[model samples]
Target: MRLTVTFFTSMLSKVVNQINISADLNCGFELACQWRNNTAGEDSGDFLITSNVRVANHFNIIPSRNNSDELFAYTHGPFDGMQKATLISNTISCQLGGGTLTFWYYRTGDSATLEVCVRQPPGSLNTADLRCFPVFPKNYAHQWLFNAVEFPPLTQPFEVVFLV
Candidate 1:
């Protein structure tokens, strides 16, 4: 019932149990990742990463993003496939060290903002300035765009998020 973490000897890995995205998410975009926890054992329950978001004939489908997929998705106007403030997050505990996040994204229109941020329990002094991918504008009407985000560090619990 008690958990202790030490940096010098042990490295604690966060457990991402589930990935939930809005139903209106575009087909061109999808999220995938691998998650595991000693407690979960990586056997029972959903622990592996998978892509469930879609936008109807807009994305390349294969399996993993790094694998030999079709290549990329077709160009589109914007992320109208999703709700105005669609949110994407995972069911994981973030009360410890923050880790580096890297992902692939593609945008084509203007004003369709893709935001990557962290949300913590109320009362934390963490400010808005300590955010990554605060706004990912539609860079080009081309293939998927690679992005990397580095967080300073996290002390308390927080949830990483992606908003469109």
Candidate 2:
């Protein structure tokens, strides 16, 4: 069957059908995908605004810098109690619009929070840059869960970054 693509009248009202993230990401970060076109009686079929990128974390739980003293750091959590970390993203060359960053994390802490950020000019190398945080002090279950954030208008390439 041929699929006919029609322009969506209301961009904000487009319902997202499914949002998914990968747990065992080789890049050490989770990704989110949202199916918004399905809500408008169209099967966009994995039309993602954001691509698989990086996530950021809190400095207290996870060190902001790596052992090499690099700004993009990655440190394992402590074994005794809950641990948290934030992942930073590289330059996201978006091919489509309305890409969502989906994050998958293990709920180590009873009340842990993960943050995902996206900058207007990706890879600004400035913590004080423009960012969008999906969850602030988000409460997670004791199991591996998937969380997603959505965007609209798959128009241009956008940078995808995150904080936790």
The alpha-carbon lDDT assigned to residue 141 of candidate 1 equals 48
- For residues 13-40, could you state the per-residue lDDT of candidate 2 as single tens digits? 1333321232111232122222112232
How big is the positional error of residue 63 in model 2, measured in Å on the Cα after superposition?
A: 24
Q: Which candidate is the best by TM-score?
A: 1
Point out the worst 10-residue segment of candidate 1 by lDDT. 1-10
The TM-score that candidate 1 achieves is 0.45
Candidate 1 runs further than 4 Å off: 1-82, 95-98, 122-132, 135-138
RMSD to true structure for each model, in Å: 13.8, 18.1
Looking at candidate 2, what is the lDDT of residue 89?
Answer: 36
Ten residues in sequence with the least summed lDDT for candidate 2: 1-10
lDDT of 1 by residue, 57-108 (tens): 5543232345443222222233454422322244434435445666565443
At residue 123, give the lDDT of candidate 2: 36
